[model samples]
Target: MAKQAVIYKTEAGEREILRRYEEILAGWPVPAGRHHVPTREGDTFVLVSGPEDAPPLVLLHGSGSNAAMWAGDVAAWARHFRVHAVDMIGEPGLSARSRPPLDSTAYADWLDDVLDHFGLDSAAFTGASLGGWLALDYAIRRPRRVDRLAVLCPGGVGRQKFGFLFKVALYRPFGAWGLRRSIKAVAGVDPGDTPEVADYLTLMFTHFQPRRDRLPVFSDEALRGLAMPVKVIVGARDAMFDSAETARRVENTVPHAEVTVLPDVAHSIIGQTQPIMDFLTR
Candidate 1:
């Protein structure tokens, strides 16, 4: 008997996913300089954009998404800051598919390695969904490295209801239809709007084997320990977690935190270009 692989079903499946991933990257609004930075965990891939002398801003995407997801937001963000969009090590990106446990501090150390590779002492950090949780974790573990923080639909700050996990469990049986429903439930939008997005995500869902480790909740002590400016925004319609509860927790826990609940927005947040820029530049 042998252990089964989890990241990709087959070598051909991996190739096809990588091909689509490159195609998506090719369509980014701005040209990005790709770099493979060495870390103790593995080689981390990052897409670099914006001016060289500008302040550094790191972008982290949600689970199942790569750096290319920032295509729409990169142009405006690049104007004021040098952006580095990272591909999480264990996700469906070009980075190493070897996933560290979600509950461990390996991700924080990996992020530290990335920053050190870039020679950045401190920088403003922005992340969405799981990315947000990683950013918050790093800020908590290595407070001195994060100058400011902005999170969209971040996890770990508050509890993730069991219902979210239950919805995910239903994705396999429901197929594309189930996936669409799950997306709408969490993202507040139909995935079919964009042909490429739909195709790419569909392929990922069908072929990519994402990590199954449950995300851990952050302690109140960790949240209270953050001294840097923190801005948290959650969608009003987010079904994955209670946005109101998250906002309340952050606002109550962190002295310099500001929480905003956007009307009609879901877990997949949008229309945040100016607001995030304002926060990072201010």
Candidate 2:
């Protein structure tokens, strides 16, 4: 008999993953804050945080995604600091987009408003891909508001090298279809239900409303003038930002920035718990 490749995949596998995510989120225990933030400029949504007075660690997720992406890490983060996971305006998240045709400055300003609404003056930021770019943009425009930053496998500029599936996901919201596949790709779901993942996508996650993930809105003047302590981590296998040249391109622009490329990882490092925790504590 001929050897067979592991092309043995099916829609059933996706449905199974979806079922498990729902179960996991429902049963898994974690530190959670149930609160809604109302802002006049943009849409208001529930903001989840851990701890009341711990140093605020703000996390911004990329497009086609929401705060729930952190479902895998919230409970653990509570041990160290107050973790604030935000749903961006204009993106497919819990936050409603007040208006469209938004620009980079507008996006940054909106983020500032969210920070203000929560009474956060200074915070540590960790973003992934598009979220990473947003984090740097915020540090650049409002340096005084940020304490520290860590951007994981960010996207934007001509620097982002994307994979086939990634390019497709960014293209459509497929909703349930997208969610099921996303879980399969992002996490190492042992044989179990992922309720935590599914609820976040269907319930808390926003795509039905006016805002979807914020599209790139950077002006050279806006992105280039930042002078803040920022750390950028890229994966060696990151089809987007996969080379030293790619890292250097971003490094050369920021005045005070550190870039690290981990060999065995991919853009999914944002979900990889350990590095992010270590970076924040340091």
What residue runs in model 2 are displaced by over 4 Å at the alpha carbon? Answer: 1-28, 97-99, 161-225, 240-245
- Worst 10-residue lDDT window for candidate 2 reads 1-10
Once fitted onto the true fold, the runs of candidate 1 whose alpha carbons sit more than 4 angstroms away are: 1-5, 165-174, 192-195
TM-score of 1: 0.92
Per-residue lDDT of candidate 1, residues 75-159 (tens digit): 9999988999999887788777667777888888889999999999989999999999999999999999999999999988666
List TM-scores for all candidates, in order: 0.92, 0.68
Model 1's alpha-carbon lDDT is: 0.83
Q: Residue 12 in candidate 2 has what lDDT?
A: 55
Local accuracy of candidate 2 as per-residue lDDT tens digits, 1-282:
112112113445434434544454455457466445655445545445567878898888865465656766777776787887876654444455444333537667777777887888988988876677778777877888888888877765335343535744763478665554554444322114555444454432222332333346444565566566667787776654544654766667765677788886755564557767777777
Residue pairs in candidate 1 whose N, alpha carbon or C atoms collide under 3 angstroms: none
Find the 10 residues in a row with the least total lDDT in model 1. 1-10
Clashes of 2: 17
Taken over the whole model, the C-alpha lDDT of each candidate is: 0.83, 0.61
- Candidate maximizing TM-score: 1
